[model samples]
Target: MNTNEEHEPRIEVTAPLGERYDEMLSAGALGFLADLHDRFASRRHDLLAERMRRRVEIANGRDPQFMPETAWIRQDLTWRVAGAAPGLEDRRVEITGPTDRKMSINALNSGARVWLADQEDATSPTWANVVEGQLSLHDAICGILSFTSAEGKEYRVTAERTPTIVMRPRGWHLAEKHLHFVDRQGRSLPASGSLVDFGLYFWHNAQRLVDAGRGPYFYLPKIESHEEARLWNDVFVFAQQRIGMPRGTVRATVLIETLPAAFQMEEILYQLREHCAGLNAGRWDYLFSIIKTYRSRGSEYVLPDRTQLTMTTPFMRAYTELLVATCHRRGAYAIGGMSAFIPNRRDPEVTERAFAKVTDDKRREAGDGFDGTWVAHPDLIPIAQAEFDAVLGERPNQLERTRDDMHVTASDLLAFKGAGGEVTLAGVRDDIAVTLRYVESWLRGVGAAAIDNLMEDAATAEIARSQLWQWIENETVTAEGERIDVELVHRLRDEVLGQLPRTASDRFDDAVKVLEQVALRPEYPAFLTVMAYTRYLGETPTTESTTQPETPAQPKSAREHARLVGERDELPIAV
Candidate 1:
């Protein structure tokens, strides 16, 4: 070698991974990984692909899972109850009376599937007493799990969230071996952007549930985007790989409240196709946000009646429509959001009016296409379920109605009304799809058996392209202005100064009766009041870390079904 005198030039190498690059890496070609492979053994190399295999499951903004089931059979709720189990931890409000505390062991025993004991930011009690109460809760859950149906058959019962008790690995193993993996956790989990990896706590815990014999159910909170849902899927995949829960044993319900999420509804629905139980209305934050959303515009839209402001507005309509479509498209249950803070006892008049309102909501929601709705109070259970029962039995047939509505076609015609069939740049329209979405929602409650115009399979969103052969058709729905407007006649009738003979159900007859109840000026003084109450729950807030989820670790189909059947048998409970 000629050294410096007559030397060959030496080349310097730098890695693309910057300072973190390894000397073992040989090439500068890789963005990062390539260089490592050159120095490392080929045996360690593998492609990083998505865990679910590269099958893209969504199509034209819909999940394949949301289709109507061809086979029809009614499912009974036996070992379960379907209403909110009041916050055992809800210190802001108390359910205690001379006869009962807001939530009771009897209610837990009354076939509720989820008894959400209060754990976060509620109550007033000593940590020790709360811990003791949790121990009691654990015992109660154990008892419930051991409970049998009226037929005296043991339905491998699984209890939920007794107290946030930590399980020694062995106790966890034993409990899981006995009952289902439990639904033992609840919290706001208030992360701003997204939730932690579903796999972070998901896989380890799900394996525990799978081992213990329970299906997995989780309530994911603080969700703000569709990517949050993807994260859930990723977690599920990892959990499945570790614990062997089937692709869908685990289920989750996202609380819909954050404003950004309202527009991302489709993506959120698609992202959690297999796992979603549907969305719920988180009222407190939503109303608070409404104030913020309208602060700049002022409160011109504010309603005098709070009830009138129910999630039943235009935005609610759009949000629910997308939700129903997404759920129906994916063959999942499209649940209606909450009607919260209603008084919980069953007063006949209150129940009747509540029933009517709920029916109307269910009907309207059904018209918009929702499968179920939430009733916040224990007392509202009967009314809510009865309303839903009317619709559940008819889904298979009404699904056909949805298909037919999809057939209404469109074509170019005069943008404005004119002589018949004059072709213009204006496009014809049929809102049957929009209307049928509402009809389908009503059908989901009753389990009715009827079939009409139900074969809804179609290949295109363009109404004309779908049935292009119809190349020419034009129609407009009857606008309200087109309806009859009859005025009182000054002319004498056939009988001379007489009106049509009245029947008991006649409109004029009913109006006359209503007029008798009020003076002509009609001032009985009916005005709604908005009030706030600072109620105290009898428990103190302790760091939730002291409490841990007590879910079953194993999942068994038979037991789960039996448990659900028992759940269905009980009247829906309210708190």
Candidate 2:
């Protein structure tokens, strides 16, 4: 054990460093991460434990309600978040994508007001990805980032006015397996992915962003409680103080995606009052959260197919309406959800239809008084911007709209029947195909994939597997009158696998294993990513080790998808 009583503990690089990793993993950066882990890792663990407790309570028929203790935070209408920071104002349209070199440049050149450079759902946290993403952001801020394709095409930031960059780190529930932190007592544990992503970005770019007339901005994800919000606020305060930036220089927009988070929007905002810039309607993950939270309650809590759960669904409508109302009343930006319609170049008709659907979605959001919305492709930027432009001809935002007419209750938010659609054979097949494709792509280092002309991420895969589990547990009857059982799911899974093309690099075999472990297993895993990461992507332990990785209770999934095929029919159904 490398005990250090006189100084801060060390952060050991467990995996072999890749090209230019030295630049990202300098002694100073490691020291900063060590300090962060030493201070807050225990608290993060406790909060995650609290999340599981909440899940168990909900599973046993305890419905979540707005807390009476936090009532003062909601009723005290005098408090408001800090006004929008310099580059965050007038966010009529924002583009979201992974932080690769080409995508980063394209997003910067795209005619949107902000770029959500995502490191969470859209990124697979391979060591190369982790370091290279930080490098891309650093180089972009310094105005020198560029990429040259193998075919000799050069990509650079060509826009005269680029979008304001806001990075989304991994959620608190994840651990960075490649790096281990040694605490003062000579104990080693995996570093928190949240801190590694945030600490690296903030440590490198805080001053550079300030020099360019912007501060470090972020999109906080998977925050379930106001207490989690307070934790992030404290992180921001500590980060800024350490870097000598003024207080509140770091602004964050919390994603109200989880079910528990919906009831505490007001309290969440109050906790991050000094650093809050807005709240986002993370539609896909919100749906997944609903199923994950209440999967065991009963059939009423079971959701319909993912295709049927649209933003216009009654419960979804209530969620978004309440989000806008809460944000505007508190002087924060109400950003709408992403329209995951990617244009198909080979089929102009497909592209045209995609444009039409995106237009209607953005139009509804604009008319509902959202300050802005998100787009996955650059071609949709003009469509989204045009809608917001029609709504606000000369204003930067609709902050004054104040959607006071909205009134939502707990029952309204939990109106699952409102998402009405049958669990048809088509829906089940779609879920299986999508999970296989998305997980395969993830294993091969692509986090965001174009499936059926839509941009799909980890959230999409989570929804697919979660719905499958929920349907099986409830013995859901399909529209075709076939009951969902282990045998039927196995046949569909094999059929989907047979249809997908097999390339030398495709991980379809592993993807199948992942689906079964997460969806077909008797016990529910809280997160499929954890199971996948630990089984396949965790560090290989190539270096000297003082301690083993701490294993948190994780959701089960396949690695190459071949592990549990023969035994599928033997797994018992849980009701």
Candidate 3:
């Protein structure tokens, strides 16, 4: 808790951030200035301890390992919306699934990347596949890292080679992923808590690559909190010690999706900011929380439609801003979120339009700006990379922008506007600092957060704190005094007023119709964009959530795998 004697945030400072400052400096000298600006962080006399603590955390968050700058939204990694259909039409969908040959090839093709193989969510398959009753996560991940499509030209793209398999965060618990039902015998489940295989998993994986003289990396999944992040750090430390793969070499990219974790973004980032290679905006899980956390009280929060709500919403903008800020602040590459679907079959318009929309979003994000965006479909991958390349468009990678905002001064910090756009510069920059840290933590793919933070009940307090303030301060909004149902009102304003813009290039009424069916229904509540996220997962990823999730299915046999690849469907790539 941070407070003054009267419980207000202290506003005075003891010393400046630098050793000495009697001279003037230019904006070009700001990078060196941030280094010097940091010394003053310890002089928080007027600030609350909590705020100052966070400030210090931000100050000390200068590390080569942190990945606040890059963007990688995990849910978009797959094209399927929980195995329903391709959200859009596209060429070559890459189906990233487990050993289960039961997965639909047709569905897998929904996106370009068929990221077959599982480590985090597919633990059931990992454990079940243990021959002699012993399965290793390393082996399991290795087993399905890459896939050969229906066309025989086996795409060599994969996170193979344990050293190449980076795990920024290694401590992962299954229950954190909401695989609710545990063993009937009621034994401690793997998901419920960090399991033993975790350390061994990384150690074995890292060792595999070290012996082969390569770097190891991973895509950490389902992270819910910071302790989980620290736990992962611990695992990496252990793996580094045991595997002899250079003590600080264990690397990973994490996913940010669940509810509580999203709010605690800064704290999570502070905990593991240095270890991230990239950050992801776990779109689907985040949307699931938006409604699931809210409407479970017998009511629902209906967002506008996907096309209308996703790319253009205030929250999404804020999220993208944070991602961009994190990347810039940390000197890491900023990535963008996914566009949800990929074209399953070739229809130039479907893919062309989808790619165009994705390109637009990515371009906008890059403009605002981001480093890269994701595509679940292989075709989309090239498109995403192309968009990024185009935006970066021949600009030589200027080492000039590297970490210039470090030693932030009173003046520099004072210039930021915060989410309200009304904050003093310092506050805005501080907020950017915090948000960036969290985004970096999210990008350490393959790691998992804890179970507690992945809440079923939503916390509206943050909405009250962040959104309400943001709404009130916005220069564009014109509403009467604090409306009774603030959340309801703001939501309605967007719903009623923010009808899709034509430039959105999506069917407004149809998108609304698609969302409303799930929203207005008495079946279940609708929050952020869970339906959209689930739609994305089912469409690209092999698995779909059902009333009852059953066993891990078998994989394609050698002959079947060969056959699936031998016959190339000379179909068009997109609509």
**Which ranges of candidate 3 are over 4 A from the true structure?**
1-201, 211-213, 296-301, 393-575
Q: After superposition, how far is residue 498 of candidate 1 from its true place, in Å?
A: 60
Clashes per model (N, Cα, C within 3 A):
92, 7, 117
* lDDT scores of the candidates, listed in order: 0.30, 0.86, 0.34
State every prediction's TM-score relative to the real structure: 0.40, 0.93, 0.45
lDDT (Cα) of model 2: 0.86
RMSD of 3: 22.2
Give the per-residue lDDT of model 1 (tens digit) for 1-575. 32235222111222132221232222321112221212221111111011011111111112222122311111211211121112211111111100012233434432322333322101112222222333333334334323344687553323343221111110000000001111112111111011111222232244444444443445454344565556655555545654555776666656555444554554665677666655544443343333222211212322222223455454445455555554444444455654433432335565556556656755665455555554434455555555555665543212222221321111111001111222121111211221122122211211111112111111011121111101111111122222111111111111211333545533332222222211111111010000000011112212324422233443353223222221111111110
Model 1, position 53, has a per-residue lDDT of: 16
Worst 10 residues of 1 by lDDT: 525-534
Error of 3 at 558 (Å): 51
What C-alpha lDDT does candidate 1 achieve relative to the native structure? 0.30
- Give the Cα error of residue 224 in candidate 1, in Å: 1.9
Give the C-alpha miss distance for residue 208 in model 2, angstroms: 0.5
lDDT (C-alpha) at residue 259 in model 1: 44
Residues 223-244, candidate 2, lDDT per residue (tens digit)?
A: 9999999999999998888878
Worst-scoring 10-residue span by lDDT in model 2: 566-575
Residue lDDT tens for model 3, 393-439: 65522222434343322222122122122223223222222222221
